[model samples]
Target: MQHQPPARDLPASWPPERTAWLNTGAPMPLLGLGTFRLRDREAVRLSLHAALENGYRLVDTAAVYGNEAAIGSALRELLPRCGLSREDIFLTSKLSPRDHGEAPTEAACLRSLQELGCDYLDLYLIHWPGTQGHPQGDKGNKERRQLSWRALERLHESGKLRAIGVSNYTIQHLRELLASCRVPPAVLQVEFHPQLAQSELLDFCRQKGIHLQAYSSLGTGQLVGRPEVVNVAERQGRTPAQVLLRWALRQGVSVIPKSASPARVAENSQLWNWDLTHADMEELSTLDCGKRYCWDPSSVA
Candidate 1:
């Protein structure tokens, strides 16, 4: 097999940070490289290698993303290059809503584990409440999500996953799980950025001892041209993407920004050097338009 060249052109110390402990006592880096749409096996492998080489300890992927195999390859190859063991990394994966039922969910999780070639997941999440017309949510997506949560809890109990979480969940869904769940979700992954502040839900998660993991923290390229973000980036002498990521980090949220470009992957990790002032944080807070770049699960009801 031919080896791909290194992806990033940055120095060794990219993230310049330590891992963060979740509510469940699992440790993950505050900033991670997200492998959501890096579908190509070689590209995903290259990107993962670049991230691990540059200083990322947490790796976020999903079975639905269809790149677990590539991520696994990267892990196998790059862990040796970086001189780190499996215990040095925090690997996260998710179960698709289609696999919400107990048996299917269990099967899907095991497949993710096998595909990723990892002994266990640092975190496993219920990808989302099932879509309206999907088979996973025939009765009610919310109820199905609860069932999936239970399944994840079982996996945690069996030591297949260190911690459990949910993605794209609203406060109502989170509150429901909190009320009835045996083990509360350690993290709530969500589509959060300056344009979709999610203040209410964020505060709720904070109070409930759930870490809010921000996905699409750059607003899926929307922040690249936004005037506010551009201005902030200029003032801070960083890219708009970095500014957006810093905004999320300032709010004490963990962020996973995906980028196939080496420069972007490196830039995304260069957010810790500067601190956004109180006014900067307050200014970006007003940019929330409640614009959801992804599907709105609430409309499914």
Candidate 2:
């Protein structure tokens, strides 16, 4: 039988100081396992186990992802066996577009918490600024977003959510939210990669002290084959995925790169042991061409 390596010891501080601190003072892992589109029950269970076993403590899911229950099951079964606890992990989930109004938003959060079998989430997010069943140009959409945010704020105040934020929010949406928000968003989750750098938004979030969490950080696998990324990978003797993830880490943005394969999950978690040179960072920065692999929220308003 082939010998498998023992799981790495959980660090005293899992992600170290590089991890971003939320406005609520909670530490969020800079790297996590993204569960977007990871819907199959067995697949999610196996992947969650593999990710946790490899030392991934941050797991991102959403009401729309349809796998929170699967992840919950995995955690219930795996945590005790792995010698970890609920507090040892930073769990995050999002409110779906369908649940944008105040009442529906609260209900959605409760359902998500029940499904995940957790009493409180480390972080919760407004999955998108646009509301479901509403036209994009409808003025009511903005009101719906505000209502949902208010619900999240209440949840955060009630201690059901340690931190609250939004995903796919552009500068316009953020400005609108900030005007009346009692609790400023602690994080902003968005699609970020070498191709779609969104430098302006990144600057805005940094100035506001909102940690940017990146989804689709690999550009949905399109970036791995790019000449610039490949060159950097070859020089560093790392895989293209690792090179891309390290680039995001170096920029101080949190990243959640999902993979069903155990080997890839292990490979993705090895970013902490190396450093990327300034020249390499500069070269990768030049690859930005405004390419977007996921939904564009720029036109939402």
Candidate 3:
């Protein structure tokens, strides 16, 4: 069996400053801008401006998001303005569920690169474990994902995807991949928040040297105003959004919170240089009653 990097439980720089070393030996920013529904070109431009100015080095997108072209155009127009270059940022996109098996997955990754106007992606992910239009429990889902991972592995080896990962995978899905993948995943992106803590999955990722990155850390904005979250924010003198996002950071998971507003984009990047007290961390942990505001991958076979 081929050996890989051993898991390190916390970021090398726990109170991460500019960047932290990922399992692939690449430095990743602590916070990133998630461009899920942010497709408008102008909105993408303004948000990219705010995010780069506020020290965000990572921009996460997916092919199905229908915004890669706009984001690519925005970056072309904005990076030079920010006094940065292509190498200065970590760009990430995902393989769509529509392209599941090996050939389609490989072609889709290439298409995303062209759409994003990049010769290579800093990171790429299998957007989901199941094939599009397939029932979650479909037996073929497992084999399809296995083939998709093979495609990603080839891309990683080709330097097209500097790192490869999976998004929206459950523990079972990860275990299935880990058993056979030549390149172990560098990250696992999921709908993680106070309500959906995903404690078990987080632990497994830590044990396996895979980074757990959180999306929908605010429960799709629903938990921002909750009495518990608000109380912590009030006590900490920060926005509820900040408090909720900080909760994940304290637990050592990376976060990508999507926002179209410029101010909100900058606000989410203010996670550095602060600490959420133990009391607040504990308080937020109690909110984890197994709630999920995003799609649940557990139903997938």
After superposition, candidate 3 runs with Cα above 4 Å error: 1-16
Clashing residue pairs in all predictions, respectively, total 0, 0, 0
Give the C-alpha miss distance for residue 208 in model 1, angstroms.
0.4
lDDT of residue 6 for candidate 3 = 28
Misplaced by over 4 Å in model 2 are: 1-15
Q: Candidate 3 — which pairs collide?
A: none
- Candidate 1: minimum summed lDDT over ten consecutive residues — where? 1-10
Query: Candidate 2 — which pairs collide?
Result: none
Question: What C-alpha lDDT does candidate 1 achieve relative to the native structure?
Answer: 0.80
Give the Å error, residue 166, model 2.
0.1
Kindly list the per-residue Cα lDDT of model 1 for residues 64-114, writing each as its tens digit. Answer: 899999888878888888888887787899998678777788899999999
- Tens-digit lDDT track of model 2 for 1-301: 0112322333454755446666666677787999888888888878888888888889999999899999999899988988889878989999999999999999999999999999999899999888888877778889999999999999999999988999999999999999989999988999998888888999998888788988998999989999999999999999999999998888888889999887888889888879789988898989999998989887776
- What's the lDDT for all of these models? 0.80, 0.87, 0.87
Error of 1 at 188 (Å): 0.3
